[model samples]
Target: MFTHRIDSATYLKLLEVQDSEKLFQLIDSSREHLRNWLPWVDKNTTVEDSRQFIQHTLDQFAAGNGFNAGIWYQGALAGVIGFHKIDWQNSTTSIGYWLGEDYTGNGIMQKAVSKCLDYAFLELRLNRVEIRSAIGNVRSRRIPEKLGFTLEGTIRQAEKLVYGYVNHNVYGMLLEEWEAKENSSTYDDETYE
Candidate 1:
């Protein structure tokens, strides 16, 4: 996987042990914010927990299933974004992302996801990309919408969160849709950069 850089910010590679401490600190500090939507936070109580997650991600990438990347904004470890899994037979993948509370509203995630879409369609040659956001998570769902993904449908009670089952709005974009967006007269050149 290549470092997806946008202007001065770089989405750095996440690896086992290498970034476990910083990753754990960010998770610990933002436990309240992240745990609200993410179910894995409570399980990530120690640096060893993060190392385990990183190791899984590393093995996932090595197996060509997918990979995760740390969003490095300016000079700090801000958050993470990556493909959840690559369904090669279907030529499809699902994207998941989260930014540290402090990094939200800075257009960092929007750019990071756009670049991920480009890599999925252009580099990986995947036909379809999906982003499923828990219903009412307006901020998290907006990235796919802003990128022109079609509102596929809602997967009611799709996820069993810590609280209860949460509905998910599934957003999808095909390679054709992405290409059309790329060739549109009003296309923003910076989007896929």
Candidate 2:
């Protein structure tokens, strides 16, 4: 039930049964927006497929494995952001996110990511979070960079893309580093915009 609203246009929250309707709507609208970047999203994916996907995500959250939040813009569904492959033993997690095409370039995703990272480090008490983006995905790479994440390295042929397997640039941020930035007098919250 945790929820956050930003700028009267965007929202982030834990998914619920009531969200299924909105979730379906978002998927239908997002198929074309995401079809290029996310290989998993197809124009033909059914509502049932999206439901099962959301159900799996919720189940993972309930099992203490991870968390996923729906992103809503201007009271309409946008996309999603989530933490996955969390290793509690190591206090680490990976961030995954996508924005509906219409909502891109408006700084909404940047703000949403800032809030998610804040929650992950300050509230969830995670030590490190990693973000990996396909080598050519400049937009995706920009999120971690804007959030002050360090560019760790590139994993050659790390993941398969729509075209084929490609190298991934890995980036990471540590809790200590985030805390230092947050506590710094020069740090500007407005930068997230």
Candidate 3:
């Protein structure tokens, strides 16, 4: 039960084999919404597929790499947030996330991402955090931008969606910058704790 509360009404729980069914349900229901930007959506056709994903994440966690954690909103599985990879030598990591259509517009991801950034910097001692969203994805891109990340530039055709390839807008935040933001009172660690 890898659980971390983001706030009074939200949390992130590690998805495991037992969670495959519920995870599948969420993905199945959000297929159309996710398929637009996520190419792997169609590949997740069954509970077993989700189980494998959970197992992989668990392995990643055990290896001290990074993890894919499920977002819970109001006690329900809402979506996922994960570090795609953690480059230990470089002390850097990249993150990705999504929320169900029904759970959007509640600032759920903003808070969730803040906590993850805190963990990356404080616990993992990562030097930088990167977030990349498909071009034109205003909602996804806004998360990093609002959090004070610098837009590094666009990677043309960085990801392949079901429909076609899409450009990605990359944003990056350094540990020093995060500390500066913390010192400036833009984000209070106590509030997240």
Candidate 4:
């Protein structure tokens, strides 16, 4: 089921078939806002599409490759965050995330990401994690930066959105660095609950 509570009002839950309608509604309402950065927004036009997406994430979890989860805030589905895929050989993975327009500016994504990092390092014992953001997506870039990831570099035209190709700014954090930061900071105990 994979639920991690971030606070009294927010948590991350693994998407399920029953969540399809809510997920689709949120995406439909946030279409214009999300379309700017998310390439699959246009393709996800129905509850069926969302169901298929959730099924795929469930399969990913089962395969032990990675996972995608819905960001539930104040009892509503606000967005999604997940590891694109894990490179077990290299002990590395890249995260991808997005928030609905109404859910921004509350530090929700940052907290969710921190919890995922805890899971990656302490639970999974992964060595490194990365987050790649479109160059112009300031909000997305801010999450990893606030969490103390180092700016690795930019990959030119790394992804193709509906409009065109976009450059991606890569941010990376090593497990050692995360451990040091956690030791020095006031991190909470709400991980993998």
Candidate 5:
């Protein structure tokens, strides 16, 4: 696994044991901010639960199912972003992420997502990636949009939140599309200058 360091912040491949403490910190720090979007936080799950979760993620990574990268900002654990429910046969994957409340709106998540997407498309050879945001989650929805993902559609009551089932807006981006955008942007910049 590759450990990526950007702007002095490292994105390390998560370990089951060594990473558990940081995972707990992330959970505790984001509890209030996450409660509205993620129901799992409402359970008030323990650090042991995070250990189990880390174990599951590591197992999945080992089995070639998916990969989760821990985001460290300024040498402290800040959040996590991952490719889950990976379908290699279908050339597709889903991207999920969360950040500590304090790190919100600082472009850290954007950088993390960009790095993960590069890994997925270039290293893993994935064709497409998807991001689903709960309806009305402006901040969450903006991630995919900022990355040039196309809004595919909305799934009504697609996810069950703490309150109840809620609609989700599905966004998708293809590797080819990303590459084209990358190339075009370079040309556009040259032309503008």
Candidate 6:
């Protein structure tokens, strides 16, 4: 299993079957809040559903497609962040993430995302990474912006949530861009919070 320590109190661990109950509980607790932006929230109605989702992540990892990791903040499940899939032919991948409503305003997602970008560019040696957020999701949009991703474009009707179809703003960062950001950043992990 892949585990990354962001700080003393924050880390990301690969999801496993044993995590179903905790994952489901977190999702259930934040259902209404998550339903606003995520389409899969309602579909995950039980622990079994969460187990299946974790199994799928395992399969994806085995297939070398990508992975989903649970964000553990201060020893609690705070959210999830993952690569949707790796397009090896293009040397790129897109990241998707969601944090429980209670976990908002903590800079957890931002730091987790920054770590993912580091992995993508430094470890995986990927050419590009992308993040797409619904137009109305200001919080989600800010993550990539704060991380220095360039606004690529908008895809109309990119995703359908509970409300209706929503436009997506695509943000991308190339390997060179990430390297530049890393070399120039004055803020360390300790000060990021």
For model 5, which pairs clash? none
Report the candidate with higher TM-score, 4 versus 5: 4
lDDT of 2 at 75: 77
Candidate 6 structure quality by residue, lDDT tens digits, 1-193: 7899988899999999999999999999999999999999999999999999999999998898999999999999999999999999999999999999898888888889988988899999999999999999999998888888899999999999999999999999999989988977543433332
Give the least accurate 10-residue stretch of model 1, judged by summed lDDT.
Answer: 184-193
State residue 158's C-alpha deviation in candidate 5, in Å: 0.9
Candidate 4 lDDT over residue span 44-83, tens digit each: 9889999999999999999999999999999999999999
Distance from true location, Cα of 147 in model 4, Å: 0.7
What are the per-residue Cα lDDT tens digits for candidate 3 across 6-117? 8888898888888899899999999998889888899999999999999999999888889999999888999999898899999999999988877877788888898889
lDDT for model 4, please.
0.91
Q: Whose TM-score is greatest here?
A: 6
Tens-digit lDDT track of model 5 for 34-58? 8888877756478888887888888
lDDT of 2 at 71: 87
TM-score against truth, every candidate: 0.92, 0.89, 0.93, 0.94, 0.90, 0.96
Greater lDDT among 4 and 5 belongs to: 4
Candidate scoring better on TM-score of 1 and 6: 6
- Native-vs-model 5 lDDT? 0.79
Give the alpha-carbon lDDT of every model. 0.85, 0.80, 0.87, 0.91, 0.79, 0.92
Off by over 4 Å in 3: 183-193
- Using lDDT as the yardstick, the better of models 1 and 4 is 4
Q: Arrange candidates by lDDT, highest first: which order?
A: 6, 4, 3, 1, 2, 5
Which residue pairs in candidate 6 have backbone atoms (N, alpha carbon, C) closer than 3 angstroms, thus clashing? none
Give candidate 2 misplaced runs (Cα > 4 Å).
Answer: 184-193
- For model 4, state the Cα shift of residue 81 in Å: 0.7
Runs of candidate 1 with Cα error greater than 4 angstroms are 183-193
Worst 10-residue lDDT window, candidate 6: 184-193
Q: For candidate 1, lDDT tens digit of each residue in 1-193?
A: 4476765665655554688999999999999888879989899999999999988999998899988988898888889988999999999999999888887877777778878888999999999999999987888887888888999999999987788889999999999888788766242434421
Which pairs clash in model 4?
A: none
